[model samples]
Target chain A: MSNNPIGNVWIYIEQDGGAIAPVSLELVCKARELARELKVRTEGVVLGSEIPESLIATLHAYGCDHVFVADDAALKLFSPVPYQKVIVGLAEAHRPNIFLFGATVVGRSLAPRVASRLQAGLTADCTALRIDEFEDKASKRVLKNKLMQIRPAFGGNIIATIVNSWQDPQMVTVREGVMALAEPEEGRKGTVTPVPVALAPEDTAVTIVERFKQPSEVNLKGAQIIVSGGYGVGSKENFRLVYELAETLGAAVGASRAAVDAGWIDHDHQVGQTGVTVRPRCYIACGISGSVQHRAGMSESAKIIAINSDANAPIFSIADYGIVGDLNVVLPKMIRAYRARV
Target chain B: MSLSILVFAKQVPDTANITGQAMKEDGTVNRAALPAIFNPEDLNALELALELRERYGGKVAVCTMGPPAAANILRRALYMGADETILLTDRRFAGADTLATSYALACAARKYGSCDLILCGRQAIDGDTAQVGPQLAEKLDLPQITYVESVEWVRKGRIRAKAQIDGGYEIIEAPTPILLTVLASSNAPRPVGAKRLMQYKKAVTRSELSARHGGRDYEDANLLAAEEEGLRARGLWIYEWGVDDLEADARHFGLAGSPTKVKQIESVVLTGSGTKDVPPTDEGIRDLVHELIEDHILS
Candidate 1:
């Protein structure tokens, strides 16, 4: 171990259009757990322009010991090249044993680049993490610095345990909702470490000509309730029932990869190994025969309700509640009852 | 000017679905039980390289880092119009992760002298680790364009490519002698040509033929005679390369050089049960919806 003491476990807070992504705070909770086990502090790494001071404190309430702000004009939008260079430089200068990033589009692109530059081992889309302890008899030393990074491998059929044996800092990207959220605290206080990054014109290889945010139709990752459709919904038109129920309950509409491939829904709303992994309070699946790929994404949902015509649908296996019925008929009545209740 | 494109491919065990008593008692994959095939995406990458070679008029070299069994893919590469093939097979290259594999491949690539372009699949299905291409670029000090959805232009010195981004795609320009990790959307690999398959059917590697004979007992005279007759008959002959041929760093070639290790494997079986059949009636729907809302499944 280097004489320079490791300061704090930092969580790179992610935000899109001024709203904090739920995964950012989810990472804070996970980092908090890790810090407790290691007897270290937890910090939040936030980068952007015009971020409110109040938002910095919000991170503290979520268990951040210090909020490191790297506000800059170039970071106003998400771009891999500049973001990676800055984070990698910071990580190299101030080494952190374990860096956690959300397994979003941006994180996936940036993590690998940073990992390559730092020559660190990075496990992607990890579902779990823990610290292990061991003693080296020959050296008369206690080897207590092992971070076991766990993620689903072989198309989600097997869970692989990956370790960064050489590098001082081990990195892993976690999918949203894999860990529980911490209770919010009031009047939390933490120091803010302001770091300055200089951006050059040549630093960014690809440029975004325009930024378009389509009228956000229910961000499924942040949705408290979700109504998802699957292949068993049968036809594209049958998806109307899923949307109707979602509309009635004010829930976001999600779909299995099969439905997305069938073009019944867009890829953004897909929930599976290749799609978004959601951990909403409630997730209702209509006509989805759950495969390991699909389950890998949403099996962690707080409450799962599967509605399938088949009695032996795999979705029923993990569902908190199972409804054996044709989704076409079951969805309509559920929508009506939800409307009536409201 | 003709383009010489080099494509890197791997033969991975088909891990699409694991079942039966195929998995070993130690929880490791039983390679013998699993059918090995040319990785689908790598085939796609090879197809793209072949298409470029055809359009621009140049030679194609296909290479792989595996055991002698990997010669199957090299022969198929020849059937697909690759001018030459190289197999970087050595007992030292076993159980390599993406990092160590890239190191060995980069060494072999350097020995291939200089090439105009190199192409590889974004990731292998078995490992699903998309690190080799980028890591190779780092080692070779070449410009890398990953997630390449399509190639707009491949000129003499510069190449224009489009990479898939989150919302859409970004078109970027990089100088030649660059590396690209082809996406699945690039193009479908063409089936083997009947003529080429028939012509190269007898092609064998030195190791393969030696193994067939239980040793290298066949006299050099007999082998030379067979090669001459086979070439005259169907243009078929073996291509061989020893470790010294590539001049790779012996220490950095395989498992011993690899830093990553698989500690344990666990099979997580997810099981649950729920409501299965609902009547197609108004009241039946009402009850279902009520339960969903009460359970916060709909709200």
Candidate 2:
């Protein structure tokens, strides 16, 4: 074995407005898996204004062996320039073989910049990852240590396997809910390595003059129940049925890409490859004929309940429970029944 | 001052609809069976670049990384008013994911040299991996604006663009020599001009000429010289560059240089069953909806 110690796999824990993003935990779980496979430790890199110690302990319970904390007032709000400079600085000092990130809006912006500066290869939106060992026919030797990053390619038609041979730290961004969240281990202990960030006023190229946070109705990713609509809903006005049902169940409203593209719903509610990838416990997909693009995002749901007028719709294939009927007529009566039951 | 803009486009296989022998058993796409067309979003990007060139009295060049046959789109670009076209084709570029692909493109961009702006589609239809533009920007160390819906302002040293986000749009201002990833909603690409189409119809790529030569040479020195002279007269020659031509580091050029690896592929076909076909009557609908609600399929 080489004398150099294998680098730890680090998760860039993302928090906004003093609340941790659900995707951060997802990356922690994924990094734990990679660390176990490679026999390396898992670390969480948290950057914020002043993160609470409780949050740092929570990261430890989530399988992080160490938490690198960089609490700077400049990091209160995400400014790409300062954040990138700090993250790149940390990465340069302590090199990690693999860096796992959540492919959120902020991550999407920062990952590319960091990868470019590090001169490393980054595969975005990876669905799965594993360690592969193989024997080379020509060399007559076994190649035991390799990171295999599997992701949907050609619009999720074929799963392409990408290998970064030249870059030191191979990186990948995972979509939310793609990996199972580890059970928080209470009383777990880990060291907190505090890194100081010297962010100057000149480092900030862009300034956030104003930040408008959309009112929290129901976060689709964190929602236990989701009521979704699709193209079969017909018109934008008819989307009210989906909202009504979701409201009745106290669930979040989701939409297939077709419905979002049709202007029937907002893009944030879109549940597909390009939009938000969701895996709700109980997903009520109304009028959605599950296309590959739609399924690539939500096939991991615990239980799917599909309702469509067409009995042969593909959504039924993945659904644990399915109903064949027009959503317009079925939704109102269903709402009445739910009101009676509750 | 006349500005110069470069638009990067790629001809990817139409993997969206593959069926009935369109894909060989070896998993390679059958190019002949699949229709070759300009990537829809890339065309929108090309249109935005062309509009910029037209509005500012500048030159537009369209560059592509694909096989020799990709010249079809370059010719179309020429007809659309791109002043020049370059094709970066080499066998070594095969099996390139986004990282390798971007490195090759950055090399090509350097070859073009000293452009005021660079434009690319937000993502390719086939890969749908929006990494290339950002990755290219990183490699070139230039300011990048992604998902741009409109070019609000463009002057000599600066450009302000509007990019779409989750709820609203953000206006970003970057200096010139920047990259913009144009969203499909940005603008409708204009149709080819008839006059320009007629003028550049005779355009032929280098691969096409080499194919025409057929390994035979004219016997007389005069005839050989004449053929070379005739080829030059037609403007059919295209500058083809190899890996060495770009002076790219061999360590970071191809599949061997990439770090990510694919382990396995499993085709998942979800299977389940539940059916309810109620009458259009209100009573029947009520009964069906009650069942749906009871099963938690509705609310």
Candidate 3:
């Protein structure tokens, strides 16, 4: 262990084009909970090219006790080698009890390298996190302060809770929208520690050739309300009803894997075990039977409403409100009412 | 130059329609009842491997670490056009999490001799951890690109790939001797070719031969040995390697080395305020919409 005592729960602040990603803020919020349970400080580690003070302030607002900044020209773009070098450096110098990363492309690639180099145990794509005590089955020896990493297993058929009791800086990469973001405390104050990042020539072996952001790619994570359809929607052309409901509600359109597999929608719009997990405030399911796989993704929503032809559809079991009817007949009337109200 | 590509695959329990019997009492999946299928994404990885082999002359070898029953996927891989198949099976290799699993795979990869590339699915549907591919790369000390969507080009010992990012896509270039974890949407996997299926349908692993011939001792199974040798000579045999064959440290073989402990597993059921039924009529729809607006469900 380093001479500096380890305690802080660190969040790797992910940013792109100099703007912080929402997932980073969400992780900071999560780290605050872990820190409170462990009685430790919550720190945000930001590595980029001249990160703004406003970004540092945002970290504080989101519950970070301190912000570690390693701003350099070499760190401008997200490269695996250089980012890992700097992160591993920080982890080595000031050992942290827990390191939380948003399971984005950058985090997923970098966490394993850091964990491997450190020989630390990491659980990826966790949906829930908590502090729990672990006991050996045979000897009954107990270990304290274990991070209980809860995630879906066997394609969302079950939830497996994993614990890495041995490794220091217990690492976890959480799904982007699984954790709810904490409200920011504006004017919140925190310390900023500037760290040195020296990049070696060999650290740039893998380079980015080009990056293209397609506006057409669907992102259901940030949607306040989601209007999702399943095979019950009937046909690809009938998918219009789902979209129309979403339009009236000013929400994103999501589809179950069955709809996508049936070629009723693009893969980008899929929400389920093989697709993206979403945690919108309100989710309206139209003609979905709610398979366990589909529920794995959207069960976290604050409220769910199901509309289906069958009253016994599984979606209705989890729904706060159920409408037993053909969505084509019911959605048109709902859309008309919403239009009148607006 | 024929590029040697190694593909890591797994046979997973079909979790599409789960029952109470899907999981056993020990917080482990009950594999006996669940039908095992070639992990869907691994098929995409295999497809990428085959496509690369076709474009730039190379040999593709598919490997999986599972029970003897997993040889089914090896046969499937062969049917799909893999030049070779290796089964890394051993009783001691059971109950491995990502860490130990990757260690055993890395050991087998080293014993397989020189490899220019390694490919795997982004994550197995069963484990859903997505750590093995990257952890395997780290254990092998190779550069890796995960979430790969396309292999653009490979020339002069360097490779370029298009991969999905947070918002869009990124083109990444890395040197050879790298590992890539392909995404599910990367490519449409090809079906089994009739000719390749006929040629590889007789392929069997040594353990399979031992089991079929009703002899635990390898030396006593004379007919099985001869038939295996005949298939081996004809290049229709799947390579079988145990822990001893790979010279893997006993400590790192399976559950002993895994740091993760599954504390509990629960079948999640979402509970809401009991659902209220709304009629199919227009007035019912209108009242429901008004109620939703009043309850702050819809704005």
Candidate 4:
């Protein structure tokens, strides 16, 4: 019914080592648009050991009006308690209208603690964020420009729109790659202010012993074409057909959540609501009976091809081309045919 | 020294294997059509707790907050060798978001007294929010370690565990009275122990006992008390508490405590476009490949 008293739209500028996480910049672009609608300024908060001038500059180029830096050696490592304390302290002092965080492993872990401390509402893994005029039908009152948080409801192909209409400092964690990356305007500037992170001995409870960073082999998001398989593709051995077709086309491979749950493939290549969401140029679905959750991730693909034995499979309904046949028979033929053309 | 480990669990709808009946034509979910299950990851948490108790000569107690029916998961926990179980239930606790849900849990946990450690699944699959465990830690002012894969050891008032990061794993250690949200990859959950299952099969909470007695019409309080007395004497009585038992602030019980509210729910409606079907023939396969190449879809 009432709005938060006074605040600007704020984004948590997440950092790994020295570079700013891409999602933080993405939020900056979105926050700029949102703040413009609300007629407020956009601010960002960065916590790390040594604040980088380039990081602050990059955020400004994307549209942050002001940046708050909490630099301390304790803040260097990503420990839950200390990180939570810094964000909570900053949020309490500023009282932001809306706060955002990346739905990365760190964000998912930290957002809740801060939200709880601030008694703020938090939505996780939001696919869509919007500002809308909400009407409380029961009260017969219209609340203007409430943050509409949208995510997929589990158990079915349903979308739920949640609102933190009753709370101050509405918070939401957005997954990476969900928003378009903003282009930088080199030399763009913003005001930088320092926020002190004072941590108690209790704050640093969990000690990190070591870290071994390994490069991820799968890059489904960057791929132009994806040859994806599903449970209908049958056993792990039969998946060789799908892999062969992908190799022939020089395309990356993906799998449905069901395929990953069945232990036929790893989690990184799984594409759907619970996994990675990809919208490649050409998406070839082999024996994949697409559910609404699966389609939510890839329905925006420029071209779609569906191959399934069941003619009535839901995937065919959205496919640019449909082939009612066995994947085992269809994949080898596709490979052979494409080879002939090459 | 023995360890007192408390495990928090939840009974959630099995959302993974949704059948056609799970959805209504109106696009909203028909929740009754789906089966209620012990949230998978919580089982992993309980398994870890059971193992710790076995190794350290302590007790493993599992707690859950939900409707009266949620006692089902607590019983399931007992079947897996949990020494004790708690069900915190009340109509006032309905419609709680993760924050409010964690509040009720922390209150019930406080009533249950302190333990050396707290364990729970990273998150429930129903919402996949992964908020409750850490939020509960905040409410209790305890330290937390999430995404834990394995516990290396617990000795001299400290627990060492391995937790997963985005690309790698980290070994972390924390003092007693800490919380760890376990991951399913940590260890395979042991199946129900036949001896324990048969032993705890008769266990039921006060609400469940009332149901079995055919509401209040068939029996009076005297008969109910007698039945409960029998259950308690034989260690088959499950602990039950509601909002009043925990002395919770009325504001923090449910919707009033929740900062978030569901504004809208819509079914994903996909409008099919023109679909061209290709014959699975030798000639058709070659022609299709040629068309893709012609369109420059293939480099």
Candidate 5:
């Protein structure tokens, strides 16, 4: 057996303007489970400008045994250079057994850089993570402290389980909203370690010129209900029915690749293999001929409602409620009924 | 000054047709069942590089690391407008994960001398790791901007790029000698130019020709070398390099250098208990909404 003792599990707490990103907290919850399996403590690594003490306390309540804070103005905006250098510095100082990040644009960019710097293996866009033991077929040796990183591969057609047994930090970036959030214990207390960030002027190569959010951008991860359209939506003008129904339900509007490819909707609203994966409470598919690629993204929702003209659409197989009709006729009446009820 | 750019692309198995022995019993990919195609996002990266060359007056060098068949993408890059193409092929480079892949790619990049910028697709659809570009940037000690949607401008040793974040977009300004991993939404790749396609349709790497002439032990080695020189003179040669050419340590290549291992693969099928059929009538729609709300499926 290798004499290397596994260290603490680390969570990269991504925050904007001091408030923690929801996905970061979710990762903290997942870290807690992994910590139990590895017999180690879970630590949250926060790198930002002026992270509040209250936020650190909240992290403690969420199951982190400790919070490592590197508050610096240089980290105010996420730059791959500085963020990566500082994170790598911290990792080099305090070795972590495992590190997990939210698979956001920032996380996805930073994790790989850190992994490479440390010569570690990283798995991205993982949907599920767990710790398991495995016995090698040839060596007959049992491998311990293996993080089973499960993700959809080969265009979401198969689920692949990857393991980084030879690396020090089993690193991964998980998709947002895919993991269950742990209940925060208000009074739980943990240590906060303040690490000094060493940044060189040269590391600040990429400077943010402008930043803004688009009003039309759909936040499907946070949406409790998603009203989605597919190829059967026909034209860009017909997509308004999806928006109107979404407005009545106070939900987000999503689309399949066909509608997006046809210019009926923006790529940001696309839901499928090459797009965003959502696990909302209810997923409403309007005129969607559900391909396996599209279904992979929404099949995790608590409830699914498929509306299509053809009764044989593949979406009906996994949907909780299947409705056969033309969305143009059935959608308007449902919107009117909901609006009138409101 | 015009820029010198190197773009990394991969030819991955098209997963859209995955079926029938997609995974081997040992938990590795079954490559035989799947047809290979250039990774979709890499085409977007290539488009960006070609656009950069058209506007800034630079050369775009395309490279891929795989078997001899991977040269197919280098030819496609040529047909699309790449100025130079290289194939990094070696049997020792098989079974490499992202860590080893980035290492070997970094070696090949260094051997190509220097570049003002490096471009790569955000991720390959097969592994879907999205780790190569960032990892390569680290090995090369270059700043990387990922999820790039467009390049706003490039001048005086700096490049302004527009990239996508979770909620919206951020325009970032970085110095030259940086790396950018482009997203699929960046731009529509142009189809192969007819004239260029005709010129490069026969472009093949030296090793590819060697395989065609019998085996590595062909009796006409000097004759094959002369033919290769003629091909190079016509600007139709695809540079091929193996582990020996790059001087890469065998211990740091292929399965030996890879840290991660695939433990298992399971074909996933989304199945529910059973779906309830709702009528197409207005009353049925209303009842459905009511039922959804009662079950907390809707607010």
Candidate 6:
């Protein structure tokens, strides 16, 4: 509980091979919205073996007031210890009021360790965040300008709004694609502070034996059309119909949590809050009874079509066209009809 | 090289099977209606730890922090060939968030003495936070590898494993005294052997045995010691530890140490106005396809 905050909201900028992740910018934009409410500046902290000049420029364009950077060969790949050292060191000295991270693989691994080192409170996979006043009736007082972190909890339709009133530098890792990515201001400017990286042999114990990048895999976000299946898809053999339809439509295949849990398909295709958040141009859901968490991911698609045997499935609520029939009978009709029309 | 490994497990409400009765009028989960099961990913973690013990000839102990009923997972661990089991149960450790949960777990873990490695699932299904394993590593001051797919080996004071990254994967090498969070896709966990199950069915924690004694505990110290001795002599005693056993500060144990508080639980209301219900027919399918084509959604 330190009252000596630097009056700035800081975001940890994640980069891979000199390219900044889009979630970093989304958080910066969100931080700007939060910072304005608190009357503070939004800044960024980037650590890479090589920080590109364009990456810094992009941060300023996205509304960061300052960018703190530490570049070194030992810090090239993302490791828990070295990354924690850099972020925790900067946080200890600057003492920002709020810190944010992207809910990516790198962000999830690093944020918890940093929070533990600082003894700060951290909320993971936050879908919505805001600044509000808290009425602590038990203590007979009101705490003003607290960060309200909202996320889905206990895996039902339950949504929990969390607050970190007991800890300073309230932290969260924002979900990808949840916040809107604002258009960059192009030529905006900000100040940059270069931090020196001091490392010992103990800090560099882990070495990257190999890194394999697969760019041609299942990319749900970039797809224009998606053919998704759910638990009702039944056996792994029945899932072949979904792949066949996706092939006919030339679209990527998606899955509900049930299909993935049943081991019918790879988890990369899961479309929901726990998985990937996607907004394709057209999303065709088959045998999927959409939960609130599932809807939170793909409800924003340009158009949605749901096919379920149960007429009362929640997926139909947001679907543009709802088919109350078996997908086994309907998916083939959809594929054949589309082929005949083309 | 024999290694000492501790695997962290949790019993979570089966979120996949949420029924209408599971939700209350205020939108909070009616937790009692949901069935609790061993967390799926933690089984993967246990499998990994067991695999290590098979190769390295070390001890694998399973620990879980929850209600007295969480002892169920510890017994299951024994059935799956775990050498030891510990149930960290205390009434004061209720309503703990991830940070306080990790703090109590770290204190409980030290009771097993220093171990070469620690393992747990990437995240629990109930919260999906994935914060405890790494937070525990930070508390223990050990390097951690998260989202691990496979452990190549843990020999000669160093560990090598392949961890899943964003797009693909990366292989890294780290020193001993490390922690790894296992993913679900790692391997198939072995089932409980019938022989082990038949033998260890009598294994009971202090709370469980007391419940069987008409909910009465041994008030005499010698009687309690003799009871424990009889169970241990028959290889049926499961270790149980409370807050005092860990020497944890009262303020840092449960809800007191939790920094984050749930402010509110928002109710969900469906609000889609223009959902067109299509009939199941050939014309209905063809018409929908034509509309999508005309809208430039399809080629």
TM-score, per-candidate, Cα-based: 0.80, 0.83, 0.91, 0.95, 0.89, 0.96
DockQ computed for model 1 against the true two-chain complex using alpha carbons:
0.33
In candidate 3, residue A120 scores what lDDT? 74
In model 5 chain B, the worst 10-residue window by lDDT is B19-28
lDDT (10s digit) by residue, model 6, range A191-237? 99998888778877878899997753888878999999999888889
Best by DockQ: 6
Q: Which of the two candidates, 1 or 6, achieves a greater TM-score against the reference? A: 6
2 or 6, which is superior by TM-score? 6
Q: Write the per-residue lDDT of candidate 5 for residues B6-57, one digit (tens) a residue.
A: 9999999986455447755643457766788888889999999999989998
Alpha-carbon runs more than 4 Å astray in model 3: A1-6, A214-224, A257-281, A291-303, A309-311, A336-342, B17-31, B269-273, B293-296
Candidate 5 or 2, higher DockQ: 5
B1-299: candidate 6 lDDT, tens digit per residue: 89999999998898888888888886567888998888989999999999999999999989999999888888888898888888888988888888899999899888778999999999998888899999999888889999999999888899999999988999989998899999999999999989999999889998777777766655555666688789888777888989888967878878878888888888676665799988878899989989999999866
Model 3 Cα lDDT, one tens digit per residue, B137-178:
888878888899999999888999999886688999988889
- On TM-score, who's better, 2 or 5? 5
Shift of residue A2 alpha carbon in model 6, Å:
16
Q: Cα miss at A73, model 4 (Å)?
A: 0.4
lDDT of 5 by residue, A121-183 (tens): 888777778888866553567888688988766543467888886757889888666677879
Winner by lDDT between candidate 6 and candidate 3: 6
Task: Quote the positional error of residue A89 for candidate 3 in Å.
Answer: 3.1
lDDT at residue B108 of model 2 (Cα atoms): 91
Error of 6 at B75 (Å): 0.9
Q: Which stretches of model 4 miss by more than 4 angstroms?
A: A1-5, A137-140, B217-220
Residue range A59-98, candidate 2, lDDT tens digits: 9998899988889888887655677789999888888878
For model 6, what is the error of residue A333's alpha carbon versus the real structure, in angstroms, after optimal superposition?
0.9
Q: In candidate 3 chain A, where is summed lDDT lowest over 10 consecutive residues?
A: A1-10
Clashing pairs in 3: none
- Clashing pairs for predicted structure model 4, backbone only: none
- Listed in order, the DockQ scores are 0.33, 0.28, 0.58, 0.70, 0.56, 0.73
